[model samples]
Target: MRSAPRTEHVVQEAYVMSRDYIRYVTGRAAKAAPTVTAAALRHAGDDLLAKYPIFFKRWPRVFKAISSDNACDYLFNILDQHFQPDKPWQKKELTWSGILSIYVLAGQLAIHCQSHGMECVLEELEVRVGEYMEAKVCPGIREKGGWSGFVERYAEKEEPERAAVRACCGVLLLLASISLTYYMYRRLR
Candidate 1:
């Protein structure tokens, strides 16, 4: 008899592949932004979704729900609420803060899925990506520089690479917490 493929193997493979693709696409998209404008981020997201139709088709309902204006507004509000800075330094801080917020939210989604015994489907990933972009680019009203310069300064001076790594670690911690919570939930049942 043929042996069935392990579910864990499938999950791990999918997670790594998807994460790498997301990082690549996001970096390119971020670099492509004309300015730190909401329209720019939305356009980039449109580009990403256009490139990955199969992923969106997998969870049509979730995609539809997330694509709504309200969903976008909610994500925008979250970023505005958390990362709003009164001073110039605070405005600069928004870059890292926004990125970290998305990582935390993605980790939360993972936790929600684990608790419900649901796989992290493509729709969930799409929504998470959208949320990340919306948070990162929507708030700044003033245009200090063009997109290329902004990306360079943010990437080099701000050290977004380091911040991203730290955010990934934070996501892992959130995952561990989810696993622990799920264990407790299961035991209690």
Candidate 2:
């Protein structure tokens, strides 16, 4: 017989987010504004998820506590690696590969969140990418002359995170629809 789908909380995979970390996070948020507290929680949760993506699923509180800006900071590091000033990637306008990477990141983020009945905002995804661009890409570009001031040139354009998140959501919806239809068909058959 096929095993029934799990509806209960599953133990998260192992990660380094110790109880002390959670205590520290909660303690820090105790006096902050709601937005600030949420941001901090989101950052903490994002860090935990990034460091231990598999383990993050177990902590329901993290999802409930995070701010809107916590779409996928996990992917930022990888993005930085790809677009760093020295990487072989062309330093002209943002390439399709870069955009595709964002889509993949958003896709993965959605998969993880949706699997746990959570949702994230497109702005959240955008903000994380923008933050990464400012923090890493801009500084790097300024320090070493990149392909003719790429950061300054495209500062207004912003990271293509929204489009990626949209694409991911679309793909996710498509997949979910297909799954649901398939399940219904099987059941009715």
Candidate 3:
């Protein structure tokens, strides 16, 4: 039987993978609608708070009584509840969007904890989130051809206005670089 990987190495690998995935998702070609990126997941979390203001209002008061372990449990439980509201047993069968939303919700929970003076939970939260994703979501992601498939499926279809803006920006950047080079050449002469 294979021995389990060291916790430290697993955590580091997860961190690297997460960073790369986020960079890939965010750096899609200009043709992609901006809403397809990770920012949309974060905005979903923000929308969650807006739709259910009671969670925000009660967190500080409830946080005072939660132990570190229980806090993580509570956070995951909330995520599961939110994502699998109708089918509790289907918690592990999250879609790609659901997987991403869990990550965003975890991040939002960390920020909420930090803001409420539980700064030390950040590292623990990171580890917990990594562990949870590896155990629960990684298999599904692999089955889907991973991040490339995610980007291909979700990142495309731009409006004409966004394409126009991107074209203008590219032209302006090229002109600015040429102008800077000419100025430098003149100064050196």
Model 1: lDDT to the true structure: 0.43
**Overall lDDT per candidate, in order of appearance:** 0.43, 0.42, 0.57
Point to the candidate with the largest lDDT: 3
lDDT of 1 by residue, 1-189 (tens): 212222333222223323433433334223343323323333334444567767545433442334322443444455566666677565555353344334434433333333444343424554544434433442331232223432343332346889999999999999999999999999999
Residues 1-189, candidate 2, lDDT per residue (tens digit)? 212112211101000111112223334223432332223333434444576776545544434443435446545555666666664675644542343234334434544455554444433553444444444334343344432332233223325898799899999999999999999999999
RMSD of each: 21.9, 21.3, 9.5
lDDT of 3 by residue, 122-152 (tens): 6666677666667656656656655554445
- The list of candidate 2 runs beyond 4 A from truth reads 1-71, 87-94, 120-123, 126-189
Span of ten consecutive residues with least summed lDDT in model 3: 24-33
Clashing pairs in 1: none
Task: List clashing residue pairs in candidate 3.
Answer: none
- Compare candidates 2 and 3 on lDDT and give the better one: 3
Candidate with the larger lDDT of 1 and 2: 1
| TM-score (C-alpha, index-matched) for candidate 1 | 0.27
Q: How does residue 53 of candidate 1 score in lDDT?
A: 65
Clashing residue pairs in candidate 2 are none
